[model samples]
Target: MNLYAIVLLVIVLTLLTVSLARLGKVKTKADYLVAGRSLPAFVLIFTLLSSWIGSGSLLGGAENAYKHGFAALWQGGGGWAGLLLIYFIAPRARKFAQFTIPDLLEARYNQTARLLGVIAILFTYTAVVSYQFVGGGDILHLIFPTVITADLGKYIIAAFVIVFTAIAGMASVAYMDVAIGLLATFTMLIALPILAHHAGGWSAIRTALPASHFQVLGDFSFVQALELFLPTCLLLLGNQSMYQKFFSAKSEKDATRAVVGWIIGTVILETVIVAIAVVGSVLFPTGEVHERPREILAYVGLHGFNGSAALQLLGALLMGAIFAKIISTANNWLFSPATNLVNDIYIRYISPEASNKKILAISRLMVVLLGVWALYQSQHIDSVLKKSLYAYTIYSAALTPVILAAFFWKRVTAAAAVTSIAAGTVITIFWDTPFIHHNVPAVVSDRDAIFPALIASVLSLAIVSLFTTPPTPSQLKPFSEA
Candidate 1:
């Protein structure tokens, strides 16, 4: 096998061993779903970092950087902005101590709101998983271009992620993330400077690319950049996977501390990712990567480190890290929606008295089913950058408003929360469709869904809550008093 393939094999083997070991620990619903609510701050930090900086950064954000340069940070900047707010919200999220964001919604709002939140999560998280598969396929194709095509690679990655996620659930996903996160963080950090050196440094890069590539907004308008920023910010604010990590913490302090580390790691790693892609764009200005910009990072991991034997080794390890990061992220996202279905929908509504074993079994089945769904979706996705934004918009516009209101706005009524959720979800889903585009005025149809969906959601929430009866002390107690 080639060096990249060998490194990938080693990573898969290590992940399998870890998953199997954790699988033996899964004897209860909480164990399988939330790592027995006992992950320490250190483990939580890496898991959060690994989960957040996935295909969205390595592929989609890199694609943006390749084309528009430093402006891609607008996407990463959104999460950084959200993380600042999350530092205060982390302890509160742990205080709520629920398995899913829907749990928090049900606790703070009502069952109908919880159901809507679950619907939004299912659509949003599954698409997130799909692009991770797309990214994984790209990695595999880079490593074994002669043997495995991207389409075939998608099936292989889907199977691997499904099996890994189903084996030990959250414990496996989180622990594996610790390893994958370290690999990626260290590899990318080390690789960037060397790649820059190979590319003749920042002076060379500035000379090689367009002037817009170095600008704040690059080639994009303020509206286009905002379109990138808002979805990412909204998604991070209401991210269910993140809340699940908080719920899995050993203590409120651990959860809060983890966010501090998570923010630092996210900032360092995301900036490094964009910088590497910027360097890669300088090295490979045209040809295959020019046609498929999302593959730039992997292309760099394969070609950018060929200066010496040692650098080639680093390149191979970097490829391994990218592949492993994609799997780690897919595991987290796939397991999250399964938790939603099991904890929020199945246990809460369908099988309240289900044995731990039955719930565990159903959870695995859900992972496989969702993996298949994500794989199917992967086939239809045209662009990772657009797909990431689309998925982010769905959750951000639909759920972020109601979620934030639950924690911060006591006057937000159940009726208003439900209306807001419905308004956001429906509008985001239809905003880009042919029907909306043709029927709606150009003024409305031309803009992204975030503007209209968020506007509708916020307006409905405020207007309805103002007209409707305010929540009672009991209804507000879980969020306010917790």
Candidate 2:
């Protein structure tokens, strides 16, 4: 993990990514962002899995598990629920041929709805990118401590992400993800079992840790689990990153196959990572573990398998794979919102006549700007899961219900859509504000932000749609035909 090795690995990966992106001949707007909507089943699945898991799943989920034991599984389970739900929604989403979530909203509702959706997306997705930078900085600092200072590490990571993302957008993201995902999957499958065996087996793990760490229900009450479950479900309902993957698929069959693959891949990989965290908890068995859960995977690399050089090499491979996952997720998430902003919002509304070449140039520039902003924000955030939850809640509350209504309920009018999105987002922000903090009970306050946001959004959608005039026959025709 010397400075030269780290730099060489990063340089090689970047060049490979850029080279693949150049192969695609991005002459049009579609090619630049969504790979001209031609991603095949395997590429789509890997990109979806890699993008969703990101730094949040690795660092954030592991940190939660280290601190609260088995309750952390709830976070990963939310994704499982989401993927199951997506099984039915994926085909339709692809049928729409929309570039972003806001594009779908704009097509079904109105420009006002699109604008509101964009606002929420930018806020939340930027926060998501911030956590990625934090994760990247952590990885860099861990591997090259003496040569790569923390400040320099953040800049290096930001530069790497920005450059990779700006080159041919989703084309680059998807192709690079194929390689990164395969590497990550193989490395995890190989390393985790070895790490566990070295840690002395299931019996030793159970003996070393408290009984609650293995509990299926965790320490949280049924009601508390419900609170956690609802937000994650809602967030996944209209996750823009997931939808983008659907749009990128080469065919309807590819989209469906990819989602099925995503479910299996996500479940298996997430379970392994969770097991790694649990094993680390058993081996370490101390309060200090909470502060450095990011190192749990790294710790395995450093100490998990001694004696055999083969085991140690497997450990190092796992570490590199984990690092790749973190970086890939960051690249995709950071790029998606900016893609939305540039194509869906900026090109559509700000300057409809802007040429594709100019739009492409601006999209690249935005990646750099976003990377710098994320790096600055990452300095203040300590918990990746909390930041991710906050971002997920904003998108879930404001857009999920409205997006679902677009597919199922023809009565959902533009006004209702706008109001629901506005009310949900505004209320959630207010709830988190200092003005209401003193009055809300600790139990309610401690729960995920999505609860209140979902309630407000759903109620507004139902109430407003019920009271107001429904869409005209023309508007209902498309949905009715489906």
Candidate 3:
């Protein structure tokens, strides 16, 4: 193969080997699920960063910037807003340590709430993982067009991520994130100035694209921006993966410290990513990138690095890092639902007395099964932006409301939580369905699922809780005291 492809392939192999080496350490259920609750601030920082900045930001958000420019920050801006809230909640999350989000739901509400929590996570996380396959496949096609087509690349991506994640569990996922986090940070920071220079500076970018590209709203309406912001914000606020990572933290301080670092890194890197896409807009233009704009960053990488440019090697490194980011995301998202399957369903309901070895075996099996399922979904929903938003809305609308109530409101009753979840989940599923969508008032039907679903969820929580009895003191103790 080409030297660039070879070099990047080597980097991928190295990361995989490092992850595989961590296998010996994953001996218990805690080790597999939460890294034995041993992650420190530094490790937590990178893992959170790497996990958050995935195909959605790299491919989908970049595509938005490719067309809309800086205004696309609304997508990542939502997470940034959510991160501020996460900083306050991190310590409490650590104090309330658990293996999965359903565990928290069951504790705060009831068994039905827990089962619904698991169902919401399965649907949302699998959708999240699907797009990662699409992104990785796009990058692979760029590197090895002759040998591995994009469709083929997707299958390979799913297989590798499945096995790699199954091998070492959270320990490898957390620590391997260290390398990915550093590489992505350095690559994006370095690539921007150089790519801007290559694109003939900021003035050139301004002249090449629409003026709206520079505006806060960019040609999008306020509602459109809100559509992007709400899902990401809600997802971050209720993200099981983040809480899981917090549970993995060695202490509350470590978890809290990590959030500060994660927020700073997210803001900078997301801005830099959009900047890269905007600059790529200047180089590749509308007709080219628009056809598959999500590949803008990959196109920029291939062009910037493969030739006689001064930053050629660094460009390839950045490209490799981007690819690694995709794989890392796939690993993270795919691993999450598997955790839910094993912890919430398998162990909790199927085999509570199952031994550690038996549990770990089933955990790996779940990873493979979920990865395959995600891959299947990716094949059907090829549009990354649509899939990403759809997935984000499901989790944001369904889980975030009840999850926040668990910590913030003792008046939230079990019946209220259960009803809220069912409302949110059902609304999100049928918001775009042809039969239901066709019959609704255009005002409600025309909007994205976030508004309708979130409104229904919140209203159900408030009104239903008013009618039902409040949560008992014991349920409020862990949340209030911690």
Candidate 4:
């Protein structure tokens, strides 16, 4: 193996070792599901950072940057906007102290809302997990092309993530994320100045690339920018993985403090990631990464520092961080849906009397099964950007409306909540399906799914709530306290 490959392998193996070390702590469902609600503010900060900055930002967001230059900050900006709002809600979420978003769903609305919320989460989180697998496979293929094609690499990635996730559950995922979080943060921070120097400083980059990249909107029209912005905003507002992290916090203070760090870290890291990709665009302007720009950051890690042995070592570790991050993200998104299945569906309905031992075993089984399913879907989706947005839209449309209303609008009846969830879920699924495309008007079919799905969901919620009876004071009690 080459020097870079050897280094990359060692980094990945070390992360796996970290995961295995946490296995003994996950002896109960509570520990496996929410790390026993013992995570302090510092741990929550990094885990939250690691989870959000995964394949979506590394791959999908980078691809957007490669194409659009700085204007691609629209994607990251969406998250920033959401985080501002999240600061106010994090304490409320921690104070509620639930295991999953679905737990909130059932508490605020009804059992039906909880079940539908699970369905939406399963679809969205699994799609997110699949692209993480695709991203990991891209890194593996970039490093070891002759031995492992991207197609085969997907299976390898799926197996490793599933095993690692199933082994330690949330406990391992959170702590391992702290290391990965710091590694990615410091590595990217260090790499950017070197990359900028290699690109001949800011002036050379400005001269070489199209001026559009530096523009606020880039090549995207207003509607196109909104298409990217809405899904990310919506997703961040209602992201189950994010809420789970908040729930895992040791106290309401911890959860609230974590969001403050999270806001600053997210803004810095996301912009840096885009900067890395923009510099890469100047270095290697055309090729497979140009064609499949999702791999642009990884491509740079392998080739950006070509001459110095020291720089090459840093580059290899950077590449390894990218690879390990894909694994961390997949573990998180995959483990999230499995938590929904076990904590929501299995324990809530199927067998309420089950032991923590059985729940722990079943959570692992669910992780394996969902990992296989996500692997199957990864074969069909062609673009990480498409999959990322599609997955984001599903959660945003189906769940964000009701979730925010639960925390803010006490008058929202269960009828409206249920209707909104159904509307959003159905509209998103059908808007992009082949059958819907064949039937809908050309203009409607050509538009982004987020507009239709989000509008349908929010409208149904508002109109239905107006027509239905307001929720009782008993139902309104949660928001009053919040």
Candidate 5:
């Protein structure tokens, strides 16, 4: 397939996404933030699936599969664990009826806690958005070398993301996701199998690849696996984006059912992507695809299937699906943080007396600011998976436990909550500092921000609660009774 044609197809699809977003009426704070809290089961399921699977899985997961084989499944598996955890908590989160994760924390803790939590969410979520932009730009650069030329491609890609996201908030993001999620799933499941069969069979794939590539555990030792395991599990426990899906659902049953579907969808789709990468490694066998493992889907689509017309169509669909996944994820990550800025930070602090109209206006403005910030940061980052881990760690380590305690533990005081959150967040930032990362030995130094953050949060919660006074009977009544 010609690169020019592919670039044109992407541009057209992007325009269609923008057009659909404009059709929705984004008048209220609820509409802009959570689709008016009226999404049915199907929409909620796809939105959750699409938002979670984004550039990280399509590009970064494939990259990991190429480099480390089946071990990459651990990263995808983390979300499955998180969804199960969410199943038990979704009803409560939905009952809270709040706009942001910080809102729940503030209700149980204090304003200071909310402020700190917002700062952490914004920093990390913005970084996640930036890396998605980088991944999309890489795709554009690969397909249309002239349009996304060496000097200007980054700017072009960033500009498109900013414009699309700034158009209509979650109103736009949700619908786009539904369309893309279907495409992405079909692309991987249908296309990859045909490509595999054409390249010979499962037998051919096994014989062609290194023996180690087939091992489920890959090269990771027990300790190294734990390093990957803990952070992912912690992040899953309280992911803000997942909560956003809960808030958007039409009802409790819809939210719960959607998440169940999400688990099944993630397991199947992620496994297929990994399988595609393994097949690519076997057939290519020269590491020629290493520089852009994310493009393996495209490479297989364009070259691997020889002369079959049906196979070619499947390949195109798969390629299109990967592109859809990138855009949908980018849209959600870019939009959700803006909701936090408006509902939790801006409306709370900047103008507490502001009307809903003014709040919605401010939300749109912040979306532009955040979109530009994401674009600027996109230039320096390289890997979607790494950026995602950093973002997830910041939220999971610092905020998840604190939020959990808010609903489940009546003894949790504002001071204890604040201390735990602050300590966890500070340690996470310190662990990621250049000096700290460089000085630590490779065996001990993996970028598991959740480690220090979760430890500090837990210790701070325990020690502070033990030393300080617990909430009074009146103060504890609401949570205790509920």
Candidate 6:
């Protein structure tokens, strides 16, 4: 194996070792699902950072930066906006202190709402995991082009992530993220300046690429930018993986403090990721990367550092960081929907009295099933950029409005919440289908799913809430007002 391939193999083995070490601790549902609600602020910060940055930023966001230069920040900017809102929401989420978002959904709304929320999460989180698989495959293929094809790499990544995630659940996902997060952060920070200098600095880059790349919209219309912005913003505002971290926090203060660190980490790392991609664009502007822009980050990691042995070693570590982050993210997104199935559906309905061992066993099984499902999904996706937005739209449009309402709007009834979630979920799922395209007005069908789904969600919520009876104070007591 080459140095890059060896580095990646070592990173994967280290992560597996950490996961196996945590396996003995998974004795209870809480221990498996939310790290026993004992994660301190420091652990929470990196886990949250690692979870949030994932393939969505490293590959998908990097693709955007490769094509649009600084304007790719539009995607990252959406998260920045969401982080600002989450700063106010984290303490409230920790105060609620539940294993899953569905727990909070059912507590605030009805059991029906909780069930629908789980459905949305399954579709969304699994899709998120699928793209992480794709990114992982891309990394492996870049490292060992002769030995591993991207298609085979997908299965390899799928198996490893499934096994690692099933081993210790959230404890494994959370603790491993601490190391991955730090490595990715420092590697990106150190690599960006070096790559920029190697690319002949900012002036050369500006002269080589189009002026539109430097522009705010980057050749996109306002509506197109909004299409990119809303999904990410909405996804972050209602990301279940993030709220799970809050529930995993040791205290409300820890959750809130973690968000502060998360915001700083997210802004810097995402920006640096994009900056690195832009530098890579200048270095290798065409050929294979031009066709598969999503691989730009990995391509840069493999080829960006040249000249000295030290630089070559940095390249290997940078590639390892990308590969590691993809695994960390896949574990997180994969583990989340499994928790929903085990905690929300199985425990709530099928076997409330099941032993801790049985629940743990079932949780791991769900992870394996879901990993296979996500792998199947990875096969169908042609672009990581489009897949990221599609998955984000599923959760953002279907769940975000009602989730925010549960805490902010006293007049929102369970009926309205159910209606809104249903409307958003249905509209987004069907928006691009052949049936909708052939029958619906071009004005509506031509637009991205986010607009119609979000409008339907918000309008259904407001109009229905106005017509229906308001929520009882009893249901409202558990949720903290923001």
RMSD of each: 0.9, 2.2, 1.2, 1.1, 2.6, 1.1
Runs in model 3 deviating more than 4 A are: 286-288, 306-310
Question: Which run of 10 residues does model 5 get worst, by summed lDDT?
Answer: 3-12
Per-residue lDDT of model 2, residues 292-386, tens digit only:
77666655555566666676566656667777787788788788888877977678878999998899888888888877777778787867777
How would you encode candidate 1's per-residue C-alpha lDDT over 425-453 as one tens digit per residue? 99999889999989999987998899999
> Which ranges of candidate 4 are over 4 A from the true structure?
none
Candidate 5 residue runs with Cα over 4 Å from true position: 1-24, 437-443, 472-482
How displaced is residue 379 in candidate 4, in Å? Answer: 0.5
In angstroms, how far off is 248's CA in candidate 4?
0.6
Clashing pairs in 3: none
lDDT of 5 by residue, 214-260 (tens): 78678877655655666666666777877887888788788878878
Off by over 4 Å in 6: 480-482
Q: 37-142, model 4: which lDDT tens digit per residue?
A: 9999999998888888888899999999998998888988999999999999999998888889989988888899999999999999999999999999999999
Over 1-482, each residue of candidate 6 has an lDDT whose tens digit, in order, gives 67887888789889989888998887898999999999999999999999989899998999999988888999999999999999999999988888999998898899999999999999999999999999999888888888889999999999999988999989988999999999999999999889989989999989999998889998888998999899999999999999999999999999999999999999999999999998899999999998999898888888888779999989999999999999999999999999999999999999999999999999999999999999999999888888899899989999999999988888898999899999999998888899999999998898889999999999999999999987888898887443
- Reference-based lDDT, each prediction: 0.92, 0.78, 0.91, 0.91, 0.74, 0.92
TM-scores, each model vs. reference = 0.99, 0.94, 0.98, 0.98, 0.92, 0.98
- In model 6, what are the clashing residue pairs, if there are any? none
Q: Least accurate stretch of 10 residues (summed lDDT) in model 2?
A: 2-11
Worst 10 residues of 3 by lDDT: 304-313
- What value does the lDDT take at residue 252 in candidate 1? 93
**Of models 2 and 5, which has the larger TM-score?**
2
Per-residue lDDT of model 3, residues 311-345, tens digit only:
67787888888998888888888898899999989
- Residue 64 CA error for candidate 3 (Å)? 0.5
Q: For every model in order, what is the number of clashing pairs?
A: 0, 0, 0, 0, 0, 0
Residue 400 of model 1, lDDT score:
93
